[model samples]
Target: MDGFSFFIYAFLSIFVIVSPLSGVVTFISLTSNMTLHEKNEIAKKAVILACIIAVFFAVLGNKLLGVFGINVDSLRIAGGILLFTIAFDMMHAKISAESITEEEINRSQEREDIWIFPIALPLLTGPGTISAVIVLMGTAPGFQEKIMILAAIVLTFAISLLMFLFSRRIHRFIGYNGMLVFTRLMGLFLAALAVDLVATGIKNIFPMLGKLV
Candidate 1:
C-alpha cells in the first residue's frame, strides 16, 4: 500500500486490534479494590507505559526480531494463544492465570500499584497489538509512513485513555452483572480473533494449507 493507504489501514487496524473495551473490563476487574483515585492513576500509568512500548517496538521491531531470529507469524501464534488464555478466563468470570497470579490478586488489595504487569505488559501492550505495530511500522515504505504508524499508536492509546477515564461511570452503568455480560461478550470476540490469528499464522507458514479443503 501507498503511504496514505498504509496510514489509514494502520490507524484502524491498531484501534480494532487493541480492543480497548476488553481493556476496560480488565482494568475494572484488576482495580476493583482500588479507589477512584488509584484507578485513575493506574490508567494514566498504563497508557503511558503502553505508548512507550508501542513506539519502542515500532522503531526497533525488525532489529529485535532479527536479533532473536523471530518472525511475525510466530508472534501471531504466540499472541493468539495468550489472548485465548485471557479470553477463556474472561468467559468464566475469572482472572487469567497467565495474566495474573492468585498471589498478585491477594496482594493487590494492599499494594499501591499493579499497573506494570497486567495493565502495561500483556493487558494493554500485549502480543497481538505489539505484533501489529511492529509489522506495520517495519513495513512502512518511507519515513512519513513510519511516522503515521506512530500516530496510529498514539491515537489508539488516546482512545483507550478516554475509556479508562469514564470507567467509574461505566462500572456504575453496567453494574456487576452487566460487567460480567460485557466481559463474556468481549471474550468471545477475543477468542475468535485468537483463533484467526493462529489460523493465519499457520497458513503463512504452510501456504498450501490455504488451498486445502
Candidate 2:
C-alpha cells in the first residue's frame, strides 16, 4: 500500500480501536475529582503506553501469531466479536470501573491510580486495537508501507490522547446529550465495521461459505 492507503487504513483502525467518543465520558467520570495536572499526566501516560503497545504489536504481532498457529482470518473473526461487544456497550454508554461511583468518590479524597492499567491496557490498546495491528502487518506491502502505517497509528493515538486530556472542555462543548448521541453513532459505525471484518474473515477462510449461504 502507498502512503495514502496506509493513512486511510490507519485512520479507520485508530478510530475503531481507540473509540475516543466512548472514552470521553470515561475520562471525565474517572477524573472528576482530579486536578488538571493529574488528569494531564494520566492522559499522557495512557497515550504513551497505548502507542508503545501498538508499535510492539505491529512489529512482533505476526511472529507471535505464527508461533500460536493462528491466522489473519481467525484473528479478524475474533476481533470482530470483541469489537461488537464494545460497540454494544458504547451504544448504551456503559462506563467501566473507570467511572467513579458516589461511594468510591466519598471514600477517597485523592485521585486513584487508573492511568496505566485499565485505561491504557485493555481499554485503549485492547483486543480490537491489537487485532488491527496484526491485520495491518499481515497486509503490508513493504517497508515503506509499514512505516506509513506506523505514522498513521501514531497520529491516531495522538488525537485520542488529546481528546482524553481535553475531555472536560469537550464535554462542555458537546454536552451530555450530544456526547451520548456521538457515542451511539460511533457504536453503530463500529458494529458495521465488525460485520465487515467477520464477512471478510469468513470469505477468506471458507471461500464457499459465501456461496453456500
Candidate 3:
C-alpha cells in the first residue's frame, strides 16, 4: 500500500481494536461527580499518557522482541491470544482481567488522580491494544513505513482524545445499551481478526501449512 493508504489502514485498525469509545460509559461514570475542568484534565492526562506508552511500545517493540529471542510470528500468536481474551471480556461487557483488576478498581476509588491508574494504564493503553500496536508496527517493511505507522498511531490517539473531550455528550447520545452493543460487535470482529492472526503466525512458522494460506 502507498504511504497514505497505509496510514489510513493503520489508523482504522488501531482505532477499532483500541475502541476508545468503548470506555465512554466507564469514563462518564467515573467522573460524573467531578467538575468539567477536572474531567477534561483527566481526559487530557489519560490520552497523553496512553499515547506515550503506545509510542514507546511501537518504537521499541521490535527491539524488545529481538532481545527476547522472539519473532513476529511468536508475537502474532501471543497478541492474538491476548486479544481473544479481551474480546471475550468485551462480548460479556466484563472488565478485562488483562487490563485492570478488581483490586485495582477498588484501590483506585481511594485515590484522587485516577488518570494514571485505570484510566490511562489499562483503559486506553491496555494489553490488547499495546500488543496490537507492536505487532502492527513490526509489520512495516521499512523505516519510512514505520514512520507512517507511527503517524497513524498519533492520529488515532488524537481522535480518541477528541472523543473523550465530548464523552458526556457521547455517553448521553449512545446510552449504556448502545455502547454495549457496539462493544460486543467490535469484540466479535476482534475475535475473528485474532484468529486470523494466529493462523497467519502458524502458517509462517510452519511452512508445511502453507496450503492453508
What's each prediction's TM-score? Answer: 0.75, 0.86, 0.93
* Model 2 CA deviation exceeding 4 Å by range: 96-112, 210-213
Please give, for residues 1-213, the per-residue lDDT of candidate 1 as tens digits.
Answer: 777787777886676556676567667777887788878889999889988998898899878988999887777777778778877887886656655556765666565657877678766787667777876765567889889999989998998888887887876787768867766876777688678878887888789998893
lDDT of 2 at 50: 83
Q: Which candidate is the best by lDDT?
A: 3
Instruction: Candidate 2: give its CA RMSD in angstroms.
Output: 3.2
Per-candidate count of clashing residue pairs (backbone under 3 Å): 0, 0, 0
lDDT of 2 by residue, 1-213 (tens): 568967786678667667776677766766787799988998999889988998899899999999999998899898888778877777786643322344543444354657765667766787778887888777678888888778878888898988987899999998999988887887788788888888888999999987887
Per-model C-alpha lDDT, please?
0.77, 0.78, 0.84
- Residue 190 Cα positional deviation in candidate 1, in Å, after optimal superposition: 2.1
- Find the candidate with the highest TM-score and give its number: 3
Off by over 4 Å in 1: 1-19, 23-38, 135-149
In model 3, where is the ten-residue run with the lowest total lDDT? 101-110
The parts of candidate 3 lying over 4 Å away from their true place are none
